[model samples]
Target chain A: MSSPFSSLHVVDLSGSIAGNYCSRLFLDFGAQVTLAEPENGASVRHVPPFDKDRRSLAFHHLNTGKRVVDLPKSKAELADLVAGADVAIVPQGFKDEIAKLAGDRCVCVEVSAFGADGPYAGWQANEMVHQALSGMMSNNGEPGREPLYGVGNRASYAGGVAAYITAMVGLFTREDDGQGQKASVDVAETAAAMCFPYVLQYFYNGTNRRRGDQDIPAGQVLCEGTWVCIWIYPHRFAAMCKALGLSQLIDDPRFAQVADRVKNWAEMFDIIQDHVRDEDAEDVVSRLQEAQVISACAYRPSELLENPHLAARQYWDGPDAQGLPRLGAPFRLSRMPRSRVNEVTE
Target chain B: MLPFENIRVVELTTAWAGPMAGRILAHFGADVTHIESPTRTNTWRTNKGAPSPVNYPDFDPGERRWDRVFLFNSQNVNKRSLAIDLKAEGGVETVRDLVLQSDVLICNFRPGMLRRLALDYESLSKHKPEIIVAEMPAFGLEGPHSSYAALGPTMEMAAGMSAAIAYHDGKPTVTGPSYLDPIGGFNAAAAIATALYHRRKTGLGQHIEVSQVEAAMQFIGPEILHAAVEGKDTKPDGNRVAHAAPHNAFPAQGEDEWVVIAAQTDAQWQALCAEMGQAELAGDPRFADVGSRKANEDALERIIADWTGAFDKHELAAKLQSAGVIAAPVNTPHDLAHSDYLRARGFYAEITHPVAGTHPHPGLPFHLERAPGDYRRSAPAFGADNAHLLGEVLGFDSERIDAMVRSRTIADAPNKEA
Candidate 1:
C-alpha cells in the first residue's frame, strides 16, 4: 500500500533542528521533502556528538531521509520551490515571503524561538533558554541545587512535533474550503506544555512544586548497583507488598492507608529498599512486572541498542548512508509501511 | 468553522497520554466524548479511593471531588463525559453503534485489553470501515514486552532518556514530571491527523499505533547514533552540550532563583563578557574559543556566576538577552502562573467550572491564522452528558436510558465497590 503522504510535497528551508525534525516526519511517511541549506550547511551540521571522522551525528539523524539542495539565491528560484510544494516549513524571518509565494493553496508553518511578534521575538535564545523560561527546568533537580535541563535538543524537538501537528491540521482544514493558511509554533510555549501537572498544580493552588527526594509508593531504588524506577499507587500497595516479600507490612497501621503511607513515606521506603537491595536489577523488574507493578532499569544509551524488546520489534532503522543506527518510525499505520532511509548526496 | 469543527471523536482512554490526545483534538473543535467506567475509574481522578491533596483545588476535596482534581481537569477540558460499563449487557453494542457514526476512537490501554473487550481495530473496522483508531501502548502490540505494564517514568527509562539526562554525579534520574506521557500524546495526535487527511482523499481509514517508548527514543536520536558509530556509551554531562560553553544555570540574587545562559556563538560569548564589565575575559586565551572555554569550563562558570549573582533572575535574563546573549530565568510554577508574557500572548485561558471554579489554564501552543482554537468550556463532570448523548446522538429512548441506569450499566457517580 502507498504511504499516507506518498504524494505530498514539502519544502524545508529553516535549516534548524526544529524545521528538520518537522520535515523528517513527512519524509518518514513517504512525502517528497526537499531541504534547502545555506552555503555553510545547516546549523545542525556544526553541532556536536560527532563521529570518529568529525562528521556530525546530529545532522545525519535529522537530515537522513530528505533531499538536500543549496538554498536558491534568487527570489524567483526560491519562490518556484515553495510554489511547487503542498507545505513549507520556514523560519520566522522568512514566513512572509514563503507564505506569499505559496499563496492560498499551501500550508506555511513558521517555526521560531519566541514566535514572530512576541516581546522576545528578536532575542537570541537556544534550547537551554527555552527550557528555563518554560517552567520545565525549575522542577527538574533538587530544590537547593541548580535547575536541570534535558540532555538533548528537547525544546527544539517538541517545537518540531508541534509544527508537524500544525501542518497536518492546516492541510486537513484546507480540504474543506481549499484555502491554506500560515501557522506559528513557538518553542517556549511548546516547552511549557511539556511541564503539565506541575503547571496545573500551581494554578490549582498558590504553591510552586519543588523537586526533592523520592517519596513512598514511587521512585528509584538501588538494586544490585543499578537504579531501577518503580511506580506504585494506592491500588497497587497490597499487591506490591506481596510480590516484594513485604507482606508483613501490609497490615501495619502506619502503612495501611494511603494518607498514612504518605505521612510516613521515608520510613516505608527504607524498608522497601532493604527488601530489594540485594536482588539483581533485572530480577527485581521481573518480579515487579509479574505482579503488575510498573518497573524498569535505568538503561544506558548503548543498552537500548541491545534491548531485547526493541530488537524484537525491529525498532532500529539504520546503518544507512552514514553507517549509523537511527530510530524507526514514530508511529505505525496499518495501511502503509515505513519507508527506508536512503543516501542523499549533497 | 473551526479546524476540526465537524469531526467527532470517542475517547476510551485513561491517564495522561491518551486523554491528552483527546484534549488537543477537543481544543481544536472536535466533538470529543470520553467513555468512563465507574468500576475502574481513571487513576488521575483518585489516587487512593480519594483525591490526592496536590491535585484538587486549594487542597480541598469537596463533594464530587472527582470533578475537581486538576490532574483530570487540566487534560479533559472541552470534552464531554459518559460513564458506561463495557462489561454490562448491551454495552459493547452501544459503543459499536457510536463508533459506526464517529470519525475516530482513541485508547491507551495495554495491547490486548481492547481485543478482550471486542473493541480492537480488527473488530471495529468490521463495522465502520472508515473509522480511524489510534492506540498508544507503552510498547508495540507484538513486542516481547507488549503486555508488560508501564507508567511514564518506566517508559522514559526503557527508552534510554533517563540514562542520558543525569546530574553531575552521573546518577541517572527521571524528570520530575512524566515527560514521556506528553510526548506520546503529541505523537498520537499527529498520527491521527495524518490518517484523517489520508481518509479524506481515499475514503479509507487505518489503525495507527504509537509506541510510547519509541516515540520518546526519537527525541534522543543523536545520542543513539553516537552510541552506535563510536561503539561506546555516551555519559551524561549535566546541563552542558557539546556545542556550547558557559551553558549552565547560575544563581541569581534571590534564594533558589537561577538564570540559564548559553553563548552559542563567538559573538554572543564576547557580548556576554562585555555585559559583565569584563571585556578582558573575552581576550583571555583560556576562554577565547568554544574549545578553550570548554577546557576551562569550571573556572569560566565561576566567573560568570559571580557576575550573575548580584542581579535579579528575570532582570538579568532580559539584560543578557538585550546584549545578544541567549539567556532566560528559570521560572517556577508560581512564576509561570503569573507570567506577564504568557498573559500578553493569551496563552492562558480563564476557564470556569461549576465544581472546580475559575482558573488560568494553559492554552494551545501553536496558532493558525484563519482557524484558531478556542477553549469553549471547562472539563465535564462525571457522566455530565449522558442525557444529551444517549438521547440525541445515540438515539436511545428515555425509558431505555433509565433502564440502563437502573441496571447499573450507566452511572452518574463512581462505583467504589465494583
Candidate 2:
C-alpha cells in the first residue's frame, strides 16, 4: 500500500524534543523528514536516559526513521532546502526566518514553550516547569504533599502531537488556496488542554479539585502483592460487590447511593481489600472484568514489552542499531502502513 | 475559509476519546454530528449511568441531565447531537444514509461492536466507497485483550505510563485525570486527517485503528527503549530530570503550595544562586557544574527549598523567571482558569450552551495564521438537531421522521429506564 505522506518532504529545524517528535510523525507516515541538526547536535542528544555507550536513547527513539543533515551555514543554502520541502517544523524563535525562507509554498509550524505571542512568551521552561504552570502537576500526587510531575517529557510530546495535527490542517488549507500558512503550538496550552475535565470541575464547583479523593471502590487496591487499579462508578457498585464475593454489601443500605458510598468509602474499601487480599492480581482483574468492571494490574515498564495482549497485537517496532525494541506507530492506517526504517542518513 | 469548511463527520462515540476526535474536526469547520443511542447514552452524560456532582452543572443534574453534563458539554461543543436507537428498526438504514454523506466516521466502541452493528469499514465501504473510518479500541481489533473493557486509568496501567510516573517510594499511580484518553483522541484525529488527505490525493478510503494503550506508550518511548536495551526498568524518580539538578518542586509559603525550579544551564544556575542571595554557592565545587549538582542534589534541593519556602509560589516564580531562571508555580485549576498568560493568548472562549448556560471553554492548542478555529456553536441540546438532520441532510420527509420517532427509532431524549 502507498504511504499517506509518500510525496511530501519535511524539514525539522527545531532542535528540541518537541520538534523531533513532530517530524517523527511525518516520517512514520512516510514523509521524507530531514533533521537539520546544529553544528554540535540537536539539544535532545545531550539529554539523558543514555545507553552503555552514552548515546541518548530519547534522541534515537525520536529520530530513528528520519534523515539527518548538518544545518546550512548560509541563508541561501538553507533556502534551497526549504524551497524543496513541503513543510518545515521550526522553533518559535525562528518562525519568521523559516517562513521567509520557505515563502508561501511550505507549511511552517512553530513549536514553543508559551507560544510566539503571550504574556509568558520567551520565558524559559523545561518539562517540569511546563507541568507546574499548566496545572498538570498540581492535579497529581497527594493533596497536602508537594505535587509530583510525571516522568518523561510529556508537555513537549503533547506539543509535538498538536503541531502534527495543526500541520495537517495547514496542508488541507493550502490545498484549497494553493498557499501554505504558518501555525503555532504552545507546549503550555497543549498541556493545559489535557487537563480539561479537572479545569471544568473547578469552573462548575468553584473549588480547587485535588488528587487522592477516590470514591468507593474506585482507587488502587492490593491483590496478591500487586497493585491493581480499579475504577468502579456508582452504577457498577452492586456488580463489583457481587463479583468480588462481597454480595452482602450489595444489600447494605450504607452503600446504596452516591453520597452514602462516599461517606462509607473507607469501610467499603476495607471489605474489598479483605476479599481480594489473597486473590491473584490476574484472577481479581478477570473476575471484575467479567462483571464489566474496569480493572487492570499496574504493569511495570519491562512487563509491558512482554504483555500478552501487546505481544499478540505485535505492537513493538524494532531492534535497531542498539538492538532495542521501540514503540510502533501510534495509530495505524490500513492503506498506508508506517515506515520501519531504523537508520538515519546524513 | 476554515480548513474543513465543507467536510462532514458522523461520530458514534460515547466517552472522551471519540468525542474528542470529532471535536477537533468540528473546531476546524467540519460539520460533525454526534449520534447517541437513546437506550445507551454517552457515559459522560452521567457518571457511568448515575448522576454525579462532578459531571453536572453547578452540581445540579437539571431536568435534561444528559444534555447538561459538564463532561459532555466540554468536548461536544461545535457539534450537533442525535439520539437514535441503532438497534431499533430503520435505525441502521438511517445511519447508513448519513454515512453516505459524511466524509468521516469515528467511534471508540469495543472492537467487534461496529461489525455487529454493520457499521464497520467493510460494511460501510460498500455503501460509501470513499468513507474514512477511524476506530479507537483499548487494545487492537484482533488482540488477545481486544474485547476487554477499559477506562482511562486501566489503559494507563496497561500502557506503562502509570509505572513510569510515580513517586520514588510510591506504587504505580494514575494521574488526576486519565491522561491517556486525550492522547488517544489527539492521535485518532491526526490519523483521520491523514486518511482524508490521502483520499484527496489517491481517491481511496481506509480504516484507521488506534489501540489506546499503544498510542499512549509513544509519550514514554525512550523509557521503553531503555528497558529493551538495558534489560531493566528505569526507576521512577520524583520530579527530577537526568539533564538538570535542582529540578524539583519545592514547597512555597501557602499550605501545600509549591514552585518548580529547573536550573538546566550554568548561567541559569548562577542566576538561581544569585536570586537566593548565595552567589558564592555557584562557585562551590559541589554545585558548580551539572554533574556536581546532580551528585549533591539532595543538599542542593534542601538549600533551595529553604529559600523558596519563604516566598509565595506565584511571586517566587515571577522572581525566578525574571532572573533568567526556569521556574513556575505549581498551579491549581483555579490558577489556570485565572492565568494572565492564558488570558493574554485568548486561550479560553466564552461559550454559552442552551441547557448549561455560559462559561469559559478552552480553545484549541494550536493557532493558524489564516484559518484559526473557533467555537462556532455551543454543545447541542439532546437531539437538538434531530429534525433538521433528518429533514434536510437525510432528505427524509416529516411524515417518515414522525413515524420513526413513534417507533422509538429516532429519539430526542434518552429512555427513562436507561
| Per-residue lDDT of A198 in model 1 | 70
Give the top-scoring candidate (TM-score).
1
List iRMS for all predictions: 1.5, 1.7
Candidate 2 yields a Cα-based lDDT of: 0.84
Off by over 4 Å in 1: A213-216, A222-226, A234-238, A241-280, B47-54
lDDT of 1 at B118: 77
What docking grade does candidate 2 earn?
A: medium
Residue lDDT tens for model 1, B167-204: 76666767746888999999999999889888988888
Kindly report which residue stretches of model 2 are placed more than 4 angstroms away from their true locations once superposed: A201-205, A212-216, A222-226, A234-280, A344-346, B47-60, B280-299
Kindly list the per-residue Cα lDDT of model 2 for residues A1-346, writing each as its tens digit. 5665888999999888888899999988889988898898778887678888888888988998687888999999899878867899998778788888988878899988887676687688887888888887887776776688887887788889999999999888878878888888888888888775666767766767666654425677788767787777778988888888888887789888778878888787777888788888878888888998888888777878787778778887666656777687899999889888866433
Candidate 1 lDDT by residue in tens digits, A176-283: 998888888888888887775677778887667766633535767788877787777888888888988899999999999988989887788789888899998878
Q: What is the TM-score of each predicted model, taking all chains together?
A: 0.94, 0.94
